[model samples]
Target chain A: MAANRSIDNFWAVIPAGGAGTRLWPLSRAGAPKFLHDLTGSGMSLLQETWARLAPLAEERFVVVTGRAHRAAVTEQLPSLGPGAVLAEPSPRDSMAAIGLAAALLERDDPDAVMGSFAADHVIADHEAFSESVRVAVDAARADWLVTLGIEPTFPSSAFGYIHLGEDLPGVTGARAVRAFVEKPSTDVAEGYLATGAYRWNAGMFVVRPGVLLDLLARWHPEFAAALRAIAADVSLLEELWPTLPKIALDHAIAEPAAEAGRVAVVPASFAWDDVGDFDSLAGLLDRSGAGTTVLGDSSLVRVFESSGLVVPRSGRVVAVVGLDDVVVVDTPDALLVTTRERAQQVKEIVAGLRDADRHDLT
Target chain B: MAANRSIDNFWAVIPAGGAGTRLWPLSRAGAPKFLHDLTGSGMSLLQETWARLAPLAEERFVVVTGRAHRAAVTEQLPSLGPGAVLAEPSPRDSMAAIGLAAALLERDDPDAVMGSFAADHVIADHEAFSESVRVAVDAARADWLVTLGIEPTFPSSAFGYIHLGEDLPGVTGARAVRAFVEKPSTDVAEGYLATGAYRWNAGMFVVRPGVLLDLLARWHPEFAAALRAIAADVSLLEELWPTLPKIALDHAIAEPAAEAGRVAVVPASFAWDDVGDFDSLAGLLDRSGAGTTVLGDSSLVRVFESSGLVVPRSGRVVAVVGLDDVVVVDTPDALLVTTRERAQQVKEIVAGLRDADRHDLT
Candidate 1:
């Protein structure tokens, strides 16, 4: 692998097929979280993600999404040509999604460095994020599997934690991965934060197509064989994609790579919010006691002035009185009111809507 | 004066013209307070008022409303034809409104006993209300001006107090009005309640056209003269109606009548609610502790289970978490969340809207 090579060899692969139930009512089955303008920003999360990566690797960008959201995915990212929308017949988790992207890139550049990015996360400090990705790509080009580790702001128990190890030999400002811990209890989360060695696993990774394939074959042969079979018929994705086993890249590759001491963590000092639920979004919004984000002609009046989160769309007004640590969202057809800590439980509302057969609202 | 006349002889004249500024956002200028289905019974306040009076009065109903609301008034009261919709050219206070109705009745039947009813009041007991009206009408026929007096349910300072004297002669349940007190201080209200002689002036009255006209001519000569002039030019309502002074019947007639010892009070035991503000409506709503009245597909969830009143419209869900004594009203264009006591101050919201030149909301 060449050192300090041109950025042209780096390709951005955005996996946007996740159903994203956490952001329900706004993000639906037909339109996943990537396409939604949750922050009231003019650009969708996927668009913003593309804008951040486009200047460095414009022509090498590829989006792997469900067949249902192909048109929306393409429409939002016009820089991506007709071939950019890689349609998955069904949602098979991130392993199949990333494998498909890597397999597709192999046809153009077999040794290309691929950066996997989730379509819904928000990175406020784009300069820092770009720098981190650039560092991660440099490590990936050297056959070192790189994962961008977000420096923890709060002891959030919702995300997986990355335990940092000794600094990587050649890669400056990067560390060898000591361990990967699943979501922990609050007490454990606080302990992890106090230790200062753990970073939030932001589910972003950088690796070469051949390196990822070789690692998957060595660790998870079954997934590797499935990916090989799918890659063989990548041109006829509609016919072969549905047969690929659904597994997240985290479980299939990242965990194994970390266990094998091949994974390096590029410490991300940037404000990277996964926007996993309304709570994460609360931190991003410019709010007072209660996290309230009023987008586009929306005003939030917190009567009790207690800590709560409210995100009302444009041309709407949400007045939250005597509420604390709650999330209130006002849409055209439906209004959602949930507690901030229980924002993840909002999926129940969507499930309830589905159970009631209100597909329109769900 | 006939003492045992059929209840049908007492025609109920409901003046639904007042554009009350107290109940704003929901109650607008185009659609006044009378038209709102605040009770979630499908029937509006005006409809409920008419229902309360319909059984007592033999379908001889007359609704005096502004020209702008004639269509809505007529539509709501389908039982009444064009004759029932008394279109006022402009907004004059209750004195001129009562005078005009009396003049119109004088042309039809001088001996007709008329019961003046506010279009937005809620009386729970129909039988007691009807009986009281009968007693008041009989007393009125004998030239004693009768006003229904509601026994105070609480030491409420929002309503004017009517002091009762000895029982009137010839009228079984009616008593002479000793004094008419304006809305009192809290201390005065407590004192009046303790005395057990003060009753809330129900804003209802019964009188014959000839007697009312004579009394008005004798006491408020200038106001009487203006109404007489307007009545003379029946076809020139637009030219004369706007010139009439905006004086309440309480200030112009009842106060003077009490001072002259000519006013009579009917001690009605019916359950009367003015339904004047959101607080009043909150009490009327069927809920225990602090809860809400949701109408038509609205779900009201009180998380902290504190006392609050949420009246979300049909097809909307309002969730009040960790709130107490707050009112949350969600509309398509605007959302109003105020303290339950400050709900009456929603009128200020309308005033602000007017000040901002947002007439569509007002």
Candidate 2:
């Protein structure tokens, strides 16, 4: 559990199983969001995420994605090998996804620590991020459920917060977890920011197979039983996986672990962005006075004397004349023009497209 | 010649011969602007032009247009009998076009008063326009070359003005033309508006077979000789029509006639709009304080308090968010977004397209 100790035998499990309807048009049912080259960089979100972890544990990397996206995941990450694309059976939430990865990884190395990462977040400072993961890995090796907690850079109400208790007796830069809080209101977020003892729960985690299995068995017996049943017959896992309960890992496991005094928080100082909404991408982009991000080969022909516009697609020129704080996404088939503050309501456009049966575009 | 005289044998010679690059994308080289259903009202400019003149002179209407648009012209106006579609050898200007129409009509009736009308001008009051044309025909019959002059409704520098010297001794609403002024500066346009003695040269004219020929002989003898030779031989006319001098009737004849004291102006109180530029259309459109005109089936879904939009096409909803005084034209193939005052410079876009060799679009 020391700082420089090699977690070389660790497996990086990316539960890339979400349908990701929030990023529609660019991401259709056939091709999910993770596979899309959102940044117009050489790698996709999944590829970038995999590449970030590949150096640490390339041989032990596993991508647990939905059956629909299994081939795409495999095709996108050629470095992962054929067996690394673990196909999930159904559209269950993060709890089942994590359990499936755990069960599959236990077959090869039961004592190995599984570092879980979301496929869609953008981490800018790789070295700092890797160091934070290493810190979390050290904490995980000591039989404590470890979570990477990003130091809040702003009063963000979008992400849940992890309150730090008194420092852990032996672990340097690691805090004893006090409590896990849901997404806060603006005032509450400001209050949390002022306290300087809160960190954004980035949904990244590190836990040994035995520790996760024990936690799941004690807290969510049904999910643990399903995983056990799937492990018994690997060939029939696809058929049985759809019937598993849909629940987030944070609600079913992380929240309970923190409540029961079994959680450790690794204070991550790396530049991290969940990139959950257009507004969230502001930090990752090069901003002008009006908060405009012209990613890839894009040029802002004319932004109407206003601000907060992010057009990420390449070879596309977008001119938001007279608009302020608006997100205008000009894709091949559709264009989305919404206020940056109302970016959360962009899901409504997806819903509208779905209700109109425009699945080809959606 | 009197106002009440009926000119029964007159033929409506429509010079439907413009390669209107000003309205590009929608108006391609293959199908010029006159063929575009701009209003989406189930009729093209050519169709509406023919319909407007059909009541005044049926079956005798002739449309001298470019060779490429002959089929479209025929298809749109099916009632135009065989040989009514006079295919121009090439896009020579209106001087040659009018000469060709005059010569063609002379083949059937030497005494026929040619009432020349442009194929694109829109007359909102058909009855009044017809009466004005009747008065112009009477003046033409009296040996004075006649032009319908629309009384100025605004100080528009976009159009030429015809200054009246005095009311004709006997003919009602007809005046001796003093001079023809070119498109004026702002001050000159204001002065013309203030005087109330100037009228927009609506480009509609009535002349006998020899009137234009006599003017051409006196002013432009070479042009007169070329037209005479082309008119005498059908094959020569076909071969040399495109290579003939490219001059507008205003420059080649009207201005000359006014200078030589041979022109008469008939004041037209009718609502006449050339619809030459976007601003002209704005005047015709029902405007709110914001200067938006929502025509046809489409709605102007302006968000963020956008203003001054004109949706002239149908079957598609156009949303202009956070834009002011900008014209957004959404066609099946192209979308044009420009400022209202700069709409006149849309011709520059057409010129650019031509320069780029996008003949399919322009």
Candidate 3:
């Protein structure tokens, strides 16, 4: 495994968050999805995220995470020093989390190109991902807010789509992002797929710190100034963090910038998964195709005439029989049994648990 | 709740055996189904069986179980005397397990009429069950090997059927056993259900101890003599028990006696369930028709649009979603997720575990 050479003036920004309630017991509030390895790989998703970026960013990295996960992020990515991992006083969603990182990086590296990626995504074929990042970094250096639009393999209504504009003159795979669309219906998604221009918006943004903050300042100047003020004082974070707007970066910046013709997309066909639910996790992990898939130790599972996923997280033996696409997630404190088609409805169970005051399980 | 009066010289013979592999993890090899309180009734199935028969037999009881399960059976039924519970050296099926008890009772009480009932069966109506046993005992007194035939509730192909002959002259519910047929096909079972002459063979037998051994002697003389010799001298149990035939009481005695016109059936309209699998166990424990049924503490389970039985035995929260007739059995070390329709297939999983040499789980 030959490592790619570190890119010049490039930094990595990892936003590790989300309770992942759809995944339920496997990914809980105490320990979210990024801290654990959803894939059977030895590395946690956060660690894998760091590994994927270390080749390009080398020692230049900034991690934005909630206060609850600060110690875990520090422990998981041991090479990241105290100054590198920024602990948010309170969650203000993606805009505040990523903008704070941008504000800090702008002061540290005057000519830096930062690629913002989520910590909980699964990326197969790292070579293709690296190539996309390399091109996105090039687009970012030119001050074009670069976003990697993943080539859609199927008509998945779960994800938002990116409409591409005319191709950038010099950049090989870079094209101007026309519009960032919200998640559409399956029938509508099929029409978008047939057009051969729409791509999955993976929320991967590459840009200079000034470019993202400048774009935010165009709409919410005070919000961008607050992030910069927190970056300047560092101690003002506790008081000013919660005062910022609670919104996703796509809605706050990316979607607006795309309409302004300031956002560019570098389309990559590498396999990517957000692992939003057990069904998606099962699909991402359906490699064995031997009727049943054991995401943990194979020895801990026993299946007969069954197909789908069985996660034995409690070191207990799980037996599934005569079921198709069934998902059984066994943990120390909770267990979930459902079909793949009903996996999205698992969030309803989490909501029910919350209503019943089962805070420990949710 | 009036307790039934003790019948003269009537002894209760409880044969507590079977691995109950269909129930798996909940009913393991080390802890069989008979020792568990599967119905959320606080008392185990073995205890429930003893309670039902204790009123009729008083202190006259003989429980034959495997050596491994002797302690558990005794612990569940603490009222039994020292010699009342017999521990077999090894499993030799129902014939050897029950015949040994009959031989011992034949000598202890010369006028003893013993009724043999399995320890793991669930009967809902105690009054009806008590009345049927009394009628079966009366038929037994007339020198007939009497069986309590349960009224078939459906066209079930899982159980053997008993064809009835003309009613006895004096006995109201007692009829001559025309034949004891094996498990029939569902189509054939439907025809059996249409005819009122067929009843499910619950394998319940009541007969005088001497008469039961005498009948055993006619077909298997040497086997009968060995059992009698063991009863006469308890020291020969470990030495001679292994040499006896391993056969069910039905195939070894009831079928032959029914063919010889020496068997009689007392049709009992009581609700009896073998609780053979999770499906039958679910059906038996479905006291509330609230769509979803919880067998253990109801508070520990959370369901959303699901129907079936959830046994939360591990003191952990179990959530089920968008499933119908689903069966979830959670234990400390193992868990089973399946549908009520495919409950029988769980036996194949148990066999697979045994074949894989996972005795710790099986």
**Each model's DockQ score:** 0.28, 0.10, 0.86
TM-score of chain A of each: 0.91, 0.92, 0.97
Model 2 over residues B239-307: C-alpha lDDT tens digits? 676567888988988897888889999998988877666555555564344645654444323333455
lDDT of 2 by residue, A1-362 (tens): 54334467689999885556655445667887778766657788898898788767757887888888888888888777888877766778888888888887676686789999999878867778878888777788888888999999888877999999887767777887988999999899999999899999989989887788778888988778778777777876877787777889888888898989989999889878766666665445643435456545443233334466445342333433334565565554554455556666666666655666756656
Model 3, A21-74: lDDT tens per residue?
Answer: 999989889899999898889899999999988988888999999899999999
lDDT of residue A284 for candidate 2: 57
Q: For model 1, what is the alpha-carbon lDDT of residue A32?
A: 74
For model 2, report DockQ. Answer: 0.10
Q: After TM-score superposition, what is the CA distance of residue B136 in candidate 3 from its true location, in Å? A: 1.4
By summed lDDT, the worst window of 10 consecutive residues in model 1 chain B runs over B297-306
Give residue B248's error in model 3 in angstroms.
Answer: 2.4
Instruction: Tell me which residue pairs clash in candidate 3.
Output: none
- Clashing residue pairs in candidate 2 are A304-A322
Please tell me which predicted candidate would have the highest lDDT against the true structure: 3
Q: Is candidate 1 or candidate 2 better by lDDT?
A: 1
List native contact recovery per candidate, as a fraction of 1: 0.37, 0.00, 0.87
Per-candidate TM vs. native?
0.86, 0.77, 0.96
Predicted candidate 1: what Cα RMSD to the true structure? 4.3
Task: Sort the candidates on TM-score, descending order.
Answer: 3, 1, 2
Off by over 4 Å in 3: A1-3, A287-290, B1-3, B287-290
**A131: Cα error in model 3, Å:** 1.7
**lDDT tens digits, residues A1-362, model 1?**
23323376889999886667777656778777788877777888999898877766768888888888898888898878988778877888898888878876765687699999988888877777777888898788888889999999889878999999999888888899988899998889999999999999999999898788788888777666666666676555676667767677888888878998999999889878877777667767754544445544543332334355666652564544445576666767666666666777777777766766767766
